[model samples]
Target: MPDVPLTDEPLILDRQPLPDGIGERLAAQLRFIAEADKLKTILRASPLAAADRRENDAEHSWHLALMVILLAEYADEPIDVGHAVRLVVIHDLVEIYAGDSPVFVPGAAADQVEREEAAAERLFGLLPADQAAEIRALWDEFEAGRTPEARFGKAMDRLEPMLLNWLDGGGTWQLPGATESTVRAREAGVVAGSTSLGSFTGQLVDEGLRRGWIRPDEA
Candidate 1:
């Protein structure tokens, strides 16, 4: 099976006569797209900068992809911008099946990984075999974070929510029990990609504290 182009609406393959093998592949692509639409309903812990509602998985992926493009220059080392963009875009797709896991939440890491891995396999499998392999590989690379692209991709993933939290007056961080240490610990991954970004986020943490949006960690 081959990759098929995605459309905003459900794919309409009836108009044209696809070659025998191609039709099934196209249908498979359509099915995957439909399945992916579920991502729009899975909300994350971060809120939109200007909106009252929380950000959803689909929106988060798009924002992170754009951030990857704009912030590529800040990466610790040179990276493949295109590959990084693909990595970010597909990174959250698994959440469609596994659901969004809030970083500050405790004791969920191991379970989240197991659930997301299962979700990745099931969701990616919906695509045509070749396309599925390509997407699954991209997801895996982003998860591993061994490559520069993956590192930067993960950085954007961590940074975007922090930025949003600050912009929304510490939206998620405003939850009563949240503290500086916990938030910083959760977002520490940003440092691996860019010390500059990490420093910038540290400043945001300070600002969050000053503005009384988050509590300080107990010594």
Candidate 2:
């Protein structure tokens, strides 16, 4: 007898219908995890000492949201404060992947563009199609720093660190060899983003000097 021929049909793995509302539930869970993961990045970026307590991503988002509420009056142009708040919340999510690049680090600043772009792709890819697109757009808008919302969001980013350093006795700036000119140059982004806040930052710098939080070079 000739050798028996085997069937050509492929074997099937287990098959079943998805549970009720499974898609919705799964999406919700993914969103929660994505949001939580972002918190990790923000805390890592924040330089707050362990004794002083660093603000995590979630706290940073909330603080920016509050700033939108409290400082709307200072915006240079009319802004959708609500939209601005949303921008701030998602702006740093990419840091979860790229890690926070401090503004003062020369190489860190130079590499930020490529690192952030890659991070945005991975971080925002976690959401459902529509949500991911929406968030990615918002992140892009903030990076462009063109629209009023983006401008304000960028301004807040600068303002927060300046305030933190000022409050914490030059928290990060107090490190040996940190200089006023360097601090001001790092903060120039605020002026480029929002003139109003940039002016405020100048005042803060002046205050920082008077308070001895920072020192002028050659002093």
lDDT of each: 0.81, 0.69
| Top model number, lDDT | 1
RMSD of 2: 11.8
Q: What would the per-residue lDDT of candidate 2 be over residues 73-137, giving only the tens digit for each residue?
A: 78888999989988998887776656666655456567778877887776677667787789899
lDDT of 1 at 104: 63
Cand. 2 Cα-lDDT: 0.69
Candidate 1 lDDT by residue in tens digits, 92-149:
8887767776766565355888888888887798788999999999999999998999
How does model 1 score by TM-score?
0.87
